[model samples]
Target: MPYGEAMLTIARELVDKIVAHGRADHPDEACGVIAGPVGSDRPERFIPMENAERSPTFYRFDSMEQFRVWREMDDRDEEPVVIYHSHTATEAYPSRTDVSYASEPNAHYVLVSTASEDDVEFRSYRIVEGVITEEPVKIVEAYG
Candidate 1:
């Protein structure tokens, strides 16, 4: 945690959705983005994305879909606040490949682990230039 407080404050509904997506895509990695107002750093819109690789150990967003989503965000004056993926058999932490592919310096990288159905681990991190810093997540009923 930064400043001894939560670094990621997200809506409970959105949290539920992310966890559900992870659970539904069990045995395979799930990937998605939550777009927010530009420079807001608030993750507001949930956009579930298809994993182009469709592999349990790795994930890659469908390029065409990524293009469309980015265009839509541009039109809406939004940026990716959160870039999230699932870990089917591992913990909610960035893998080496994830660290290599993380390019959004301003976005929070969220990881959801579906390794245990009853205990779905949802963690947030900041991955900048290969440095990974774990942050605390605060799930609220809604953004106030």
Candidate 2:
């Protein structure tokens, strides 16, 4: 199924942010979100949330900030498009932790890794209570 165009952009930028944050911390998890409408051609918002700690191989997003963002998006008539996180030393696929936590079927789970920053991989998934079903992501560029 078509996951949508905006998710591709979100996936790309999320990789960049993850790389920058990883370089800054040298070896820590960088977590964030890409909140927008599901089927928009171009994304209208990109909100990055800070990870709670500086660690070697873990990322835990701040729940309070997450709630705040959800509210803000809801006010704008937008849904939680995708929940993104980075794998500092692993590949760009979901781990067991990721699978276990991806309970929202309506949202896409994006995972970026630092294996090759320039060669970033973007995969979309409909995660339902620990079961992940991969979804296809498509990008339609703007003319302007």
Candidate 3:
């Protein structure tokens, strides 16, 4: 996906994994990264991270764990294609804090809302320079 007209093309399995993580975390926010080949917009690796805050409304990745994950991704020559977090009670939208912490301009910011037991809302956005632009998500069985 391009910059202006961005789209998050992810796998169904990855989506399921994210949803499961969100559900398992319950009232707390869950966060993770989907890594892929650097420059390849496809998400291939699911790297769930611990939410250091452990709060229902806010999420902050565990710093030490994040360091290790980044090192592993560097060794694998991968980049965070999607940075995801769950909202326990709110809609699948980025919070002000989330937007302020948007460090990966090229990564898709995916939000999964686990507010309802019956349904889940998954959304993707491009947060660049503090401006968030919601994008379309296309979940496929797998990448070619």
Residues 1-144 of candidate 3 have per-residue lDDT tens digits of 244347888899999999999999989999999999988888899999999998988888889999999999999999899999999999999989999999998799999999999999999999888888998999898777
- Highest-scoring model, lDDT: 3
Shift in Å, residue 87, candidate 3:
0.4
TM-scores for all candidates? Answer: 0.95, 0.73, 0.95
lDDT of candidate 2 over 46-144, digit per residue (tens): 677778765656677788988898898888877766676667677768888788777656677776666564565556666776776676665434323
Off by over 4 Å in 1: 1-6
lDDT of each: 0.91, 0.64, 0.91
* Pairs that clash in candidate 2: none
What's the distance in Å from true for residue 133, model 1? Answer: 0.4
Best by TM-score: 3
Which ranking of candidates, highest TM-score first? 3, 1, 2
Clash count in backbone of candidate 2: 0
- Clashing pairs in model 3, backbone N/Cα/C closer than 3 A: none
- For model 1 the local lDDT of residue 59 reads 93
In model 1, how large is the Cα lDDT of residue 49? 100
